[model samples]
Target: MVSIRSVHGSAQLLLDVTGGVTDIVEKMHRTIAREVNPLNRLRDMTGETPVAKQGHTYRIIQSTTSLLKQGLHRSLDGLSAQEEWELSPQSLKITAALNGVCGDHLEASGNPLAISMHLRNSRGEKLQPGSTSLSTMIPDASPRIAVLVHGLCLSHEYWKGHNEGNLGTELQSAHGFTPLYLNYNTGRHISRNGRELSQQLQRLIETWPVEVEELTLIGHSMGGLVIRSACWYAGELDLPWTSRLKNAVYLGSPHHGAALAKAGHLLTSVMRQFRYASPFALVRHTSAGIKDLRHGNLLDDDWAGVDQDDFHPDYRKPVPLHEGTRHYFIAAAIGKQVWDLPSTMLGDLLVRLDSARGQHSDDLKKLSICAEDCRVFEKLNHLDLLDNKVVHEQILGWLA
Candidate 1:
């Protein structure tokens, strides 16, 4: 069931998006036209002057633009009187996908999916730390707190709806730990998100009704990098929350680098090698968050003064696990064991085993987790690391 408001908002977004995309295509078309020289090649045969041909092309472009605008306007005018119905889950999924890809853009443009920290209750109502709101949100705030941070393109609701036993519920039932969720725009740089998270965590702690005892952080994918960034920022700023950190857990975190991002970088490099493909290379001009994953950047200085499109060798400053907090890591493989070649190569279909394990040739860049502290769950992909039974058991054992 789609609401009129959602439909109208999406229509507006589509119109703006179409304009942006067309601008790029128009530029590319001009470049192609110049290279092809189709008009010049056929000028004599067509018996047309260069000026006339140019006028014709301009008219065609204008007509197409007008038609597109008219079509969008007509669609907007065609909405039915019935405003509510049972909406398909697919529509929400599509909206979430759009947000994940260009959430930073949406936020910049003040669009519908601009994300924020929404500490939502079981009924999907937002919670606040004010006295009245706190009582309603958390009837019994526990001393121990486990904050679950979702990965790229995900909302905090992901943890709640995952097929496995809800992580927050499990921790609460087994260890008397209260759970907090963080929802954020993943399209921003990890360092940027990290700085904000550091401040937010401090506020959350300061506002807690009970005396904060122990704090544990759990992050997945890009969320892991964000946690690491937050820890570094907190330490640099001398924030009090870092002092209470008891443990940090990373699930399928690409501590070194993600191969997919590297591959995308390589593709962009190759595309830009040709003059014709140069403009189209803008296709790879993704958000800062995706770019930071190239070398697992965790500090503000890591990307200072570097042009977003320029490719540089990975020489990022090393950011280790928080010294005072015990760190645990869970890596996943799609095979029976770690030695399986395909599993090692694919590494749960996103992060490689070595990268997830924070194993690097340079000891300076390597994360210092003992072999016994790391576990590899088999027959699971990256997303499965979120809800798999074996992975959940490992998390339980580590927390215990």
Candidate 2:
């Protein structure tokens, strides 16, 4: 259920968006007003006066909008003090997408819309790691555990869609491995989420009702990158959960980088070079998570001091697969056959073939995955990797 807190957060976000659009529109109007006059345009072109001074009319409009927004904000605050309300499934989906786009900003601004990292059951109930109630939450807990992580703009409930829920049931029935789902804000940096996940997993293992003999991690798309990041952090911190980890599976994961994210970065960078286009670029407010996807960044050092808006080459440090654990990679293509050009160039429509396979032009950055350990399914797009029965069967076969 959506709470009163979320309602207020949504209202706040709407006001912020309205304010931003008003500012942009004002700038655009000013630019147009200046350019319409030849003398002003000439001055702008010569850099003598790049921006025209704000007119009295523009100031009055901005002031009026600001006042109106402030009034709305106060009203929303009052509404927020009311009893909690239930959030519908549709609202939850929208909130997840919003988080993926600007989750870092939401968190920084203390917006209640920001999703905190947590483990959840299929019913979407939060499961506190190390809590005594964990056994009650998962009564059929097993010695072998498989934790499923979803991709960007998604919640733990994603696994329960399109018959994919059977993956968990079958895993338990076939292998005596209990399944758990990880729910988190996908807009945060992968390294940050990874660090938190490492700690969470440790607490889970320490508090598990049964003695854990094996742990398997399965992730799709960005979730795979998060899992890899968590593994790296876990090793660095010497977390005990790392000892129980036996297998890590990556399905349609961009180990090197995603193609679409790089394209977006390039597009925005190019736009920032021109004055009129710069406003549009500013409108693209991508999160740190989206920026990290440009080159599969999984460390703080990769982006700490760099300006994301400026064009920069890939500078991510290499993160290797966890030692003492078997790794598997699954890739998909939209084409009907592996030999098809589309299959080779545009695997899964979002991730490229080589990237999903952890292939890199530079040897130092390549993942040392075995040829037999990687599988590519044709005629499958990115999201299909999550729901397809073939993908699930392949996962089971590898675990078996």
lDDT of candidates 1 onward, in order: 0.77, 0.84
Name the regions of candidate 1 deviating beyond 4 angstroms: 1-5, 38-93
Residue 66 in candidate 2, Cα distance off native in Å: 6.4
Determine which window of 10 residues in candidate 1 has minimal summed lDDT: 80-89
Report the lDDT tens digits of candidate 1 across residue range 16-63.
Answer: 666666656665765665567856445635646553465466557656
lDDT (Cα) of model 1:
0.77
lDDT of 2 by residue, 82-155 (tens): 65644566787788899899899889866778888988765667899888899899887789999999888887
Winner by TM-score: 2
Task: Report the number of clashing residue pairs per model.
Answer: 3, 3
Cα deviation of 189 in candidate 1 (Å)? 1.1
Best of the candidates, lDDT: 2
